[model samples]
Structures are given as structure tokens and as C-alpha cells.
Target: MILDKEILAGLIEGSPYPIYLILGEELRVALANAATLKAWGKDASVIGKRFLEALPEIDGQPFEALLRQVMRTGEAYYAVNDRADLMIDGQLKTFYYTFSYQPVKDADHQVIGVVCYATDVTQLVESASNISRMGLEAVENNERLAAINEALAASNEELATTNEELTESTRLLELSEGRFRSLIQQAPFAICVIRANDLVVTELNDRYLELVGKERTQLDGKPIWDGVPEAAEVYAPVMEKVFQSGEAFFAKEAELTLIRNGLAEQVFVDFVYEPVSDLSGNVSAVMVVGIDVSEKVRTRHAVEEVEERIRLAVEAAEIGTYDLNYKTGELVGSARFDEIFGLGNGVNRETIIDHYHPDDVHLSVLAHEEARKTGRIFYEARYIPKGLPLKWLRFQAKVYFDANGNRLRTLGTVMDITVYKALQQQKDDFISIASHELKTPLTTLKASLQLLVRMRENPNTVLFPKVIDQASRSMDKITELVDDLLNVSKINQGHVGLKKNWFNLSDMLEKCCIHVRESGSHELILEGDKSLMVYADEHRIDQVVVNLVNNAVKYAPDSREIFLGIKSLGEMVKVSVRDNGPGIPADKLPHLFDRYFRADERGTQVSGLGLGLFICADIVQRHGGEIGVESEPGQGSNFYFTLPLGEKEE
Candidate 1:
């Protein structure tokens, strides 16, 4: 009796092993079950395609040749552990499978086509592929012998012979499945197996090894954290949970530092730690499956930072933000925006139009319309609320669109320009007032001087010459004071210019002492090393020394003696002026250098705008130097400053 093809197919299809049927001599795959199709990561579309065509990733591999050889020679071929690089998720990866190719013969005892039976052994062989390539060609001695002996048997006697052959095939398939492993090991998803006890890596697929920048030899059987120290802190606690509790742990968009090419890099991943159990139902290992989303995470973070910076800029500028939904005719605003418009957060079409001043309503509508049509907004309008102050609001916005280019909404900013307007007006008014006030007084003084010159021939002119001289000196002092005020303004505006040149610090001190000595009974003394050179604005330093020495004389009139000293430090020089009078109080000393701050007047003979020390402080600071004072209640005070040494050094 000949076994029907349908019956043979039914027997093999019920087996769990991957099985495919080939037709005619071409070995075109006739049928492939769900298990075989899934292993290939293929679908029903591959049913009619040739086995080689279906798995183009396996081109140049030995499977095609082995299958054809089994058909050509009528001998069975078995692969113990084989490497088949297959395309998985667009990336070609190496996979190992243990399988067999057996010949199927026609009723005439001539080989027609071959049957392919496979068991995925990738996980088992990948861990130890370097061991050797174990491929063996074997013939089914028992099956062939039984086929020959039973060939001559009566048709009724052949049933038992067929039963014995079927039983042997089933036993072989079971042994193969048990010895090999799952093809899922070659999946694109990264998988790393860590032993439960030491949490050491016992096995990892190619994808996992590549993701972590590690070699199998370096990581297999090693502590998981030893290779990637960054993952230790992040994975330890969660892995412990999975191992001890036997519960799986999952994290989406988790970030951790990993070593890539010898540099620490941040990698974001979606991953899971699953507990794998042994035959005894005890959890033995933890498997890690991860997908790297580092690029996506970095892109998202960059966008978030840009958005945050925009938010901060708006806040710092005190600009208000708003979103206008054109479809819904609604306007929503941030808190500051609502404050600017003097309205509640529920801004709609009514408030957008009516909240503005009546005079600006027409201009606001025109701007809104233009923004909707052109996707850009640039306009300024007034916002006047009942019983509240009016403000000039500058409106700026841009429109956005949906994916289909449908008009979506507008995002805009509003800023109150009232203070800017007020300052501009004040600037204009000050110029007019100063010109009128100064010109009239100067003109009157000039006319008075001319009249005096004209009267110099009269007897009264002789008496008035001193008066004219005094008036001229008074005018010069007034002009100087005015220039000082202007200089103070320029310094406050951070526009003061310095003419820098090299000068000797000790010589400048001596000249300042000489000037003080000329007009006062107080003795002026200079000490310290001479010829100390410094890089600075020489005129500014001269001004600083003059102010310090004069202040010492004015504040300590009782102290006839003053000491001006200069010393050289490394790359720097120090200058100090010490005075001995009823010394400054501790509280008053701190404010002495502050602009317009006057010390105790009991001993101070100085009278001016009180900007001398303030200007000195500014001059020293601009040259990258320090200026301060040291004083006590009864002891005299010392005002000192230090300057960097110039390049010209003796």
C-alpha cells in the first residue's frame, strides 16, 4: 500500500517543528505552516515564492545547496549547528538553526522533491559559534531497510510497517527541538540574559551587544554593571524587583549613560526586565529587551529647551502672551497678558475687540485681519480700561497652520510701552529747558563783563576789576561743576572712555603730595619703592591720587602730617594715602566712597558734589583694580588702591 500525500502532510504538519513541502524536482515550497512562516518573519505572501527567493537575506548561505543536494543524491542532509544570516527589521543578523533536509520519493521509487524540517538553534549556537561548524550527512538506515523489506509484503501487512516508520520520524523531531533553541534570539529587539544570583550576564544576542558597545567575550558571564557602570545605578533596583518578586519591570523613555567608543554618552531607551524561569518553576535569570530612543529623546529635549527660553524671554521683558483660536473665535492669555489688557483670563471675540481704546479699535481689527491672511502680525495699539490707567500696548504675533494647511491659530505677544513713551517725552523736555535756562544766565554774565570792560576808564571801574575777576572765577567753578555732573551721567550710562598709557605710580604720588603741600600747612610725605610702573589711564590715576590726598587733608585738618606710600606686589602695585585726624566712625566709613555720601562734617572741610571718591572707585574698577578704605574711630584712616603692573618693567 502506498501512503497518500495528504496523510503524510497531515502527520508532519501536526508536529511543532518548522516544516515545508517542496513540489517536483525544482523543490518549489508547496506548503509552510504557521510555525515556519513566523520563524522567517514572513507572512502568507511568501507561500508561492521559492525558499531562496523568500529568504533573500540567506543568499550565499549553505541551506539552498544542502536542500538541492538532498534532492539530487536522494540522501538526507542534517545541519547540527549552522549560521544563517537573516534580515530582521531591515538589519541583517546572524542566526543559527539545527535542521534536516529529507528526500521524498514517488511511487516508482525515484526521488521527486525534498522536505525541509528545521529547529531554530540560534540562542544555543550564538553563545558558542566559534566552537565549530557541525554539519553531518546521514541516511535513515532503519527507514530505508523497512521500505525495502516491506515493499514486497502484501498490501494488508504493510500497515504495521508504516506505523513503525512514522513513530521513528516523530521521535527524531522531538530530540531535535529539545537540543536546539528558539530563533527569537535573532530578533531585532535587544535581549540580554543576566543570571539571577550574581546578576551577571549569562547570554546576550548580537543586537544587545551592539547596543551597549561590548563584545560577547567581554560581557558574557561578567557582572552586568561591570561593563556599563552607568546602567548599574539605573538597572540595579528595578532588576532586583524583577528577580526577587518574579514580576516583570518595564520603563518607557528611560535615560541612562552608556559608554560608546570609550566616551560616556546618554542613551534613552524603552526597555523591560523580564524574569525567565527554569524547568523547576524557579526564576533563574533576568532578560533585558531594550530599544534605543536616544535621538528622539534628545530632539524632544532640545525643543523643550527652546520653548522654555522663549517663555523666560517673554517674562523678563514683561511681555504678555496670547493664543487666538480663529475657528472658535476665542482668545486665551497668560496671567501677565490678562493683567496688561485689564481683563479676565476668559478672552473671547468680544474682549479682543472691545478691550482696546475706542480710537484704536479700527486699527486693531485691521491688524487682526492682516495676521489671519498673511500669517504675520506687527502692530501697536492702545489698551484703555474703565476706571484704570491707559497703556500703549505693542502687539506682535504670527499665525500657524494645521497639517493640511488649514488656518489654525495665532500666537502673539503684548508689551506696555507707556514707560518708554514717558522717558522719550522727558528726554525731549529736558533738552529744551536746559538750553533756555543756561543760555539766559550765560548771556547775562557775558554782558555784565563787557560793560565792566567798557567802564574800565571810569573811577568806578578800578573798584570793580576785582569784582569782575571774582565773577569770572565763579563762572569757571560753575562750569567745572556742570562738567562733573555730566561725567557722572556718562559713567552711570557705562560710556566713560579711558586714555591708557604707562606711568610710574611712585612719581604720581609724589606730584600729588607736592600739589597738596603748596596750598596747606599740612606736611605731605611720600614713601615706598620708586619707579613702580603700571598700565592704566595715567590721567585717571592722577585724578584718583589727587582726590584721595585732598580728602585726607580736608577730613583730618588737625593731622598736619600725611603719608603717601606705594609698593610693588607680584604683577601689581599698591598706592595708599593715610591721614591722622579725628578718624571716621566705623558706620560712616563704609559709605564714604558711595556717590554723594558725606562723612562727619566736624572735621571735613571738603565741599563739592561729593562725587570725587565715587569717580575714583569707578576709574579703578574699569582698569581691573580694587579700591577701599581701612579706618578706626580714634586711629587715622587709610584710602588705598592697587593696579596691575604694566608691561614696561625695570
Candidate 2:
């Protein structure tokens, strides 16, 4: 396949089109004829130069790679109408060419060089492109016509089907009249037809006979004076009005005295007298549809007594109702509520909640969201109502859902609990004064009694020593109760200071649980993180733990095990006391931490004043933490409190 250098030079020189020969690894141009040099805007000075150097304008052209590929594989390459930017007459112009890269092989079948031949085809390529665009336009027009024809076919089919349905509707109308008669005979409510002109009974269904206490032999097709005289006088006028005005009459809570059980009993009803039309669209008869609502009326009236009692109590307490519209964020107040809140009738959620004490606003919002989830709300907070100074108000709401079953609104009452709060403050003050006054003398009495027992030879020698021992225990119980009261009073006065110091929460829990188990039949098991530490009032937190543990032992008598759990939760440390008792009821869970609220209906034989959890809640809340319980009827209970793991410097 090899060609001599001299022979290849003569062939290239004789070629009429642009052609060039390149050889070796460097791809230097072996020869370029007059046409090749002319097309490149160069002369014979480019001969024996690198193919790229001869025409540096085509530096990134595809021909270079194509030629190298053929020289390596010894296979010829052909490209048609390949684009190239060439410098012709010292000006760059775009050109298209059909070119070939042929391998020039030496002996032993090795490709030593590549010869390139090219022919310009810019005019032919442009003409074919124009024909392709015209073909595409014709295809698109055909497709549009095909779509229109398909739509026309669908329209024709719909018209034919519509005519068929019209004919079928006429036939079905005749059949529906017979079916309507059968349906009226089997209706559940009382249905009776009366003649509009004479106001006489025309037809009566079975339910109508049952309602009126008469049968077909006495009542059917009868005049007003012939059968039920009482019914005629009352229904005749209503029938006459419906027929004359062609309008239906609907009566809610209508009462009719009928003879039943040998006595005249008043029967309540919700009845509608609808005018029946003839073929000419004239009122021909009056059809009565009545539903018995006697039982519902009786039940409502009986419950009204209880509701009236509650209403009087609310009025006496100056409680008022309010509504929260979640969609518009508006707050609607009742007369008393408006007077207490002074927000008139048009306040918003943000504006009203903003009026709450800044520390308690977040808790109010949480209670609101909880109401939406559980459909119950009960919380107390301080509000700065306009025209009135800050007062304590108890917010209670019931959530209502929209048609789509989403929480739509919350309607509830707000009680002016300022007076109650003042009373509570006074009670706390009295307890604080009494506890402080009693503790001093009680301490002196305990010391004097102990010294007397020591002066005797032995405690068993004197009968009074046993009495003193029992009295000491009684005094100890009283002292503990007084301490709790004092703590609560401190909390109420905002003086329950936290002596915060870093201490192990688990160790504190163990000590509290051990103290509770010392006098009880319960066993305490400490679990979870043993090394969890928190910065809080050690004595105050101990009181919270002891309160929860004592409550578990009191309520859970059947179960002997109580679990004390401590865990680190992000920046907060959690301490929980779980019990295996007969858990709390759902209705009583909300009031568990309220002051003086005992869940046991049988009274407080086991608990002192029901202020244990209340005191605990106050202490935990003062430390900027939360206390809660998770319980169900039979699943036992878990009461937990969380304290933030305060900042530390290492």
C-alpha cells in the first residue's frame, strides 16, 4: 500500500481539488499541491511543514484526529460535509467539505503516512436542509387535520347518545309515579294526604294511623267532623295555607294532646305540610310528614335544670364565655368576658395572648395546642386586660372541628379568678405564719420530753414514755405538713429561691426514694443514667422527688415496686418516678397537680391535704423546668420532671 515519495508528489501536484500528504509521528506535511496551498492562502513555503503549522487557522479542526486515527489503525476514514473554519485570501470563512483520510502503508503492513482528499459541498448541504424543513411542515398540517376529524367523530357519537337518553327518560318518568306510591306507603314517618278544597282526610299511611290512634275503618276518607275532631281543627288551617300559598310549612317542637293510655298526653312533633301538585302544576293536596320528638324534648327539659344551676353559679362567680376562631385568629368575648378582658368583641389570638404575663404566655399556647389534639383545655394564667389591672383568669375551652375534621375553633369560659387567687394568697400567708409560730414551741416541747425520758432509768420503766413516743411521731407528721405549707407560701410569694449547685440527679433520686421506702411497704429501684448532673436547688428538688415517691406509694397499694429513673435529655436532665399501681383516670389527669385536688372519691384517708404534687409542681416550675405524668386506667403511671443542665466553665 506504500507509494513512493516522488510518485505521490506528482499525483498530488496533478490533483485538481485541494489535497495534502502528511507523514511520520510529528505529522509534518510531506507535500501540498497548488490547490491545497491556494485554499489555505499560502504557497510552497508550507511544504514539508507540520500539517497544523501550514494552516494554523484550523488548529482545533477534526481532520487532524481523523488523519492520526487512520495512520494508527491503517484504516481509511471518510467524513461528509464536515465543517471547517479556513483563512481564505487572509479572511476567515466557514466552509463544508466531503473529505477522506487514507492510510499509506510501508512494507510489513505498517501505516507510515496518511493522504487526505477533500471536496467542498456547502451548496448541496444547504439545498437538502431547505427540503427537510418543508417536509416537516406538511407532516404537522396532516396531524392537525387528523385531530379535528377525531373530535368531530366524538361530537356525533355524543349527539346520538343524548337523543337515546331523552327517549328513555320519558319512559322512566311513567314508571317512577307507581314507585313513588309504593315509597310513600313504606315511609318511616307519619304521612297523610288531605284534600285541599274540603280539608278532609284523603289517604293515611300505617305510621299516620299509629300516630293518631285510629284505623282505616274509622279514619280513611272521612270529613273533619266525622273522625279526629282535635286533629282536623289544628291541621285544617295549616293545610289550607299550604294549598293556597303553595308553600310548605315546617313546625319544630309542636305539641299535640292525644288520648293515650286512657289519659291525654302531650306529644311533641317536628312536622312539615308540603303542597302536592297536579299535572297542571296546581296545588291539589297537602301531604303531612311528621316525626315524633317527644323523647328528645323530655330529655332536654330534664337536663335544663342542671344547666340552669350551672348558669346561675357561673353568673354568681362572674364567669364569662369566649371563643377563639383559629382561621381568622379572632377572639370573641361575652358580656362579662368583655368587661373583665376589656378587649370588646373583636380581639385576636396574638393580641390577647400577648396580654398574658410574658412568663406564662408560652404555657398558654401549649395548652391551646393540646386542646386541639385532645379536645380539652384547662389552664390558669395572669392577664393584663384593658381598663382593669392585671388579674388571674382561668381559661377553659372545648375544641370543635370543621367539616373536614380539622380543629376549627375553641369555645370556652374565662372565670375572673382574681378573688380566688387573693383568697389562696391569704391562706398561704396564714399557713406560713402558723407553721413558723408552731415550729418554735414544738421544737422546745420535743427537746423537753426527750430530756425527761433520758432522766428516767429506762424508757420502759415509765408508762408515760410510750405516750411520749407516740406523741413525738404525731408531732413529726405535723412538722412535715407545716414545712410543706411554708414552702407553698414561699412559692406563692415568689420567694422560693433555688440554691443551684451541680449535683448528681441519680444520687438525689436514690436518696429520696430510700427515704420514702423507710416507712412504707414499697421498694424503690433506681434506673437510667447514673452520672447525670444538673444545676438546681438540691433541697427543693429533693422535696419534688419525695412528693412523687410518696404519691406513688399511696395510690399504688397493690404494687410494691416503684422505679426512679434519671436520664440526660439534650440540655435538660430528666428524673421520673414510675409506679405499678392501678393508674389514674383520664378525667382526673389534668387536675392531678392542682392545689387540694384529691382523685380518690372516698376522701383523703391516705393523703394529708392533696398538696404534695401541687407543691412539687410549684417548685419544679420555679426552677424553669416542667413536671408531667403519663398514665392510663390500667397502665400504671409515670411522673417525671426535667431541669436544664446549666452552663459550665471548664
Candidate 3:
């Protein structure tokens, strides 16, 4: 009868094993299962094909003899140490078998075909070999009969110890098994098991499932290579080598090309394929464990690019970069150093040294020589261009060395400061020139005026008072110019300071008004806060008020009235000089207090330097107050300032 279930009758409708076996034999029937038969390296269709034909290499000799013995004797036999040679994939392989064979007799007690049951015993044989190597050793007792008799007592003690050891070993084995399972299941990296025979996935952990983007149930019986094509392509060759050689292999920063969201991204993986061996030391499968390192790779690459860009930028800016070899008295420079020094863009040891000014070259040479002895080099010097003016450069350097304690080189940066240096020199020269040229005339004029004053009392002098008065006025004008210049210079140098003393704001304002009225043609009016006491510099504040009033009298000469007022604003004092004269033009108001600025086209006739308001501003600032002006063309101008009162001094 056909053993195929669909073609069988009602009696064949039980479990498929019995319907196919038709005999009381478990292994024989299980061996007939097509799926199980495939594991033995036979074609799946060998379920119906005769076993002899499927395994021709092992069909004769011991296998055939065992089958005949079971059939003719009508007996059952079991053997776990069976060995045979079989052809698999056209290669001869030695295989071990665990099988039981029984005779199937007809109703008349006649034997039919043999029932063969089997399982692969290759793994068990290797385990047995390992057990033999680790088995308890024996010692021969060859002493006297008395020692032999004492062996009986020792036997009982040894047996008890052996029992205790067996119990401990069992406990240890349980613990080790638990740890093994935990390690496989809780690994941070993906872990997967592949069948060595078929290259198919047999089991996978949650991490592996997540890596594949699939459920375990869907991937359990599938080939690992089929799902992860990129992974397969990258590691399959190594995996093949691992399986064939039964060795473990690893890869670092292996690139895996994957497509996600219709875009391709490269992933780097640090992975290993360890051979999962049965006790025989033959690889049965590969255990793959991998960590994703794509982020690390990308980060390193980005950092390298940023560093490269910074290096290029420093070079392109023509910044003279340097590193000093302190121990060797050597200097290194970037490519731009040559061009900066007016050398022909070829950077070398000689080219860098040639950039130093001739006068400064000895200093640089000495500095490096000193650094060679002291292990340090840092300086700022001027380098004279070959055919041009000298240029200033600053060098910032540090020394570093390797682990061997040998001083290597100094790394440094340099910059050109020529323009700034030139401007500073020009400023100093101007100050010196102004002092000599301007002060000389004032001294000569003062001396002449003094001699003229001495001749004023002579009998022959007619217009002596008028001449003296004109000379005094001229001296006054020159003194004002000198004072303004000194005041501005002090302010620029951050040296302007208040010389404070107890004074009345009202009295100071009146004094300033008296001076302005005496010196100008405009009529003056004084008003407000006669008792307002302020803590301030008496002379400087007097200068500010007088300067403002005088400026108003000069600029607004067309109007006759000028007003000087001092008042209390909160705890502070406000002093103002107001004029009812043709005021400052709106266009010139912004620059009214700028040094050496004149508000009108009419010059030399005004008979004063244009530094009155500038000095006024400086004096007010030094007193920790503010100065301001209000004006409209053809109307009037009011210049005012505020200072802290004595009550608000704190």
C-alpha cells in the first residue's frame, strides 16, 4: 500500500508516523519523515525512494549486514557507536549514527523488510570523546596486603566525596546554563544563529529581530543571507571562510550599504562571526554579533574636514604661521610666510630667517639660540621690508614634545601690525611738531608784549594803554589756544582729572558771567540759585562755564543779551549760558564741539581758537557731568551743563 496519506485508506488516517511505518517502531517511522530525512544530507524525496539508493556509499557492508541480521533473526538491536562513510555534495564524509533495527514478522511468523530507526550520533560521539579525556583517573594499589585491606575503609570515604562533587557540578552546570541563556538573550548587539548545514537562520534574539526589521516568527526558518542582502554581501565571504575553516572572524568599520526612505545611507559595523560548533569542533552554524558605528564614523569624518578647512583658511589669509624647534634652534613657517616677508613664496629654513629685519635679525637669532638652551621662544619685533618701510609683527609661540622627553618644536602664530605702527608714529610726530612750532610763537609774542608793557610808563609813549590792551588781548587769545590744546591732549590720554574743592555753584557762575561780559561786547544777565553748594573742581568748572558763555558771546555777536543761570535740578546743579544772538547754524551743530572746529566762515576776525567748546566738553566730562547745547539759526543758543550737588556726592 502507498504510504502517502492522501492516497491511503481509513486505517491509514492515524498519526502520519504510524501510517507510514505500519509497524511498532518510533525511530524507523521518524526517519521516514521527509523533513527529518533532509537533515541527514539526503534529498527530501528520499522519503519514498529506497534508503539504499539514497545513500549508496553507506548501503553496503556494515549497514547491509545489520539490516539482514535484524530481518533473518527476527530480533531487535540497538547500537549507538555506529559509523559509516557517506557521500554528501559529491564529497565523502565520515558520519556516526545512533539507530535501532527491528524485524517485522508476518502473521505466519515470517520476517519481511527490516524496520530501521536512526538519529545522527556525530555530536554524541564527540561528547563521549571529551568525557573520556576528562574521566576520573585510576591509581594502582601495589603496596603490602595491609595497605590493600585499608582500601576498603577509604573506598566509602571516596564514594561520599564523589557524591558531593556530583551535586556541586550539577548546581554549577545549572548556573552556567542560566548565564549562557541570559548572555544570548540580553546581548546589546544583535545575535543570530544560522544552521551550518543549510546557512538558514534557526533562532534570533530581539536585537536581531529589530536589526532585520522583522518579527522572529517571520524570520525563524528563513535563510539569514536572504533578508540582509547588504550584510550578506559584506560578511558572507568571511562567513564562508569561517564555516569551512571552523574559525571565528571579525571585521571593523565594515561598510554596509542600505536603502531607507528611498535614500541610500552607508552604515559602519564592527562585527564578528563566531563558529557555533558541536562538541566535534566542527562548525555547525555561525553566531553573528555586531555593533553599529555609523555615527562614530561620520563624526570623525566631519571633525577631520573642519580641521582641514581651518588649516586652509589660516594659510589663505597669509598669516605667517610658525613652530619653533626650541631644542634645535630651528623655526618653521607656513607657505604664506614667504609672501608676507616679500620673499618669492618659497618657504624654507633660510627664507623664513631672511624675513627678519637686518637690525632685528640678531635678536631673532639670539632668541632662538637662547630657546635652544632654555626651551622657549616668544617675541614681538619689527621686520623691515627689503625695499619698503618697516613692518611690525607679533609672534605667539609654545613648545611641545613627544613622550620621550625630547623637546620637539614650538608652534606659533604671527601677524603684520605695520599700519597700526605707522599711525602711532605719525601721531607722536604731530604732537611734537605742534608743541615746538605753536609754542615758539607764543613765547616770542609774550616776551615782546612784556617789553611793550615796560615801555608803557615812558613819557614819550602816547597810545601806550591802547597798545598794551591790544597786546594783552592777543596774549589772552594765545593763552586760550594753548589751554584748549592741553585740555584736549589730556582728555585723549585719559589723564584728565577733577581738582575738587568746596565751592558755590552760584558764585562760580557769576564769576564766569563777569569774565564773559568784560571780554565781550554782549550785555550779560545772571540768574538763580545763589546758595546752591556743589562739591566739584572750582577751576575746571569755572573754565567750562566761562568757555560756554564766551563761545555764546562770540558766535551770537549780533544779539546784545547773554544770560548765565545756575539752578538746582533734584540734588544736582544745572548751569547754563543763554544768548539772544544769531545762533549756531543747524548744519554745523553736530560738529560744534569737535576739536579745532569752527562754526562760521568768518575767521581770524572772531579772534579766538575754535577749541572753546571742545575744552568745555572735556571739563564737563571730567567733572562726571554732561554738556549740551540748543540752537536755531537766527534765534539764540543756550549751552548748559549739570554737575552733582554736594548733597548727592555719594
| Candidate 1: tens digits of C-alpha lDDT, residues 1-650 | 01233344454555555777675555577678776877777886776568777888887887778778887899988675567787877888777766667786642346767767676657544533321121010124334545645663646577676667656655654544333223335555577878988878876778787788877777888898887776777678878888889998867567777887677777877677778775456789887867675654554355335545665677789888777777887676777887887767686757666867788888877886786668778887777776888778888877777656677778777889998876777666545544543565477577767777777677374658665765675575567457657878989999988888877877777766565677667887888988778888888888888788778877888899989888888888898989987788888877877765568433235445566788889999888889999988779989999888865558
Estimate every model's Cα lDDT from 0 to 1.
Answer: 0.71, 0.73, 0.63
Per-residue alpha-carbon lDDT of model 3 for 1-650, expressed as tens digits? 01221222232222122112312221123224442344456644454345565567775648666666776688877775478787777788887755566565532356655555454546545543432333211011112222434554568766665555555555555555455545567655577878988889875678767655666665688887676665676567888999999877866557877553334667776567877665456788887766565554554445335545556666565466655554555554554555567665334555555767677676666665666566566676777667787778866555555556566666666778677787777567546545644565577667667777677677336666666666666676567667777877788898888777788776666656665566567777878878888888898887777777677766677777878888789867788889887777788888988765667534534645466788888787767788888998777888899888864436
Off by over 4 Å in 2: 1-205, 218-254, 260-264, 268-317, 368-377, 385-389, 398-408, 450-650
For each of the candidates, give the backbone clash count.
0, 0, 1
The local lDDT score (0 to 100) that residue 428 gets in candidate 1 is 65
**Which residue pairs clash in candidate 1?**
none
Return the candidate ranking by lDDT, descending. 2, 1, 3
What is candidate 2's local distance difference test score?
Answer: 0.73
Q: Where does candidate 1 stray beyond 4 Å?
A: 1-185, 195-202, 221-241, 349-359, 369-374, 401-408, 441-481, 487-650
Where is model 1 poorest over a 10-residue stretch in terms of lDDT?
130-139
Error of 1 at 315 (Å): 2.3
Candidate 3: count the clashes. Answer: 1
Candidate 3 clash pair list: 324-410
Error of 1 at 160 (Å): 14
Over all chains combined, what TM-score does candidate 3 have? 0.36
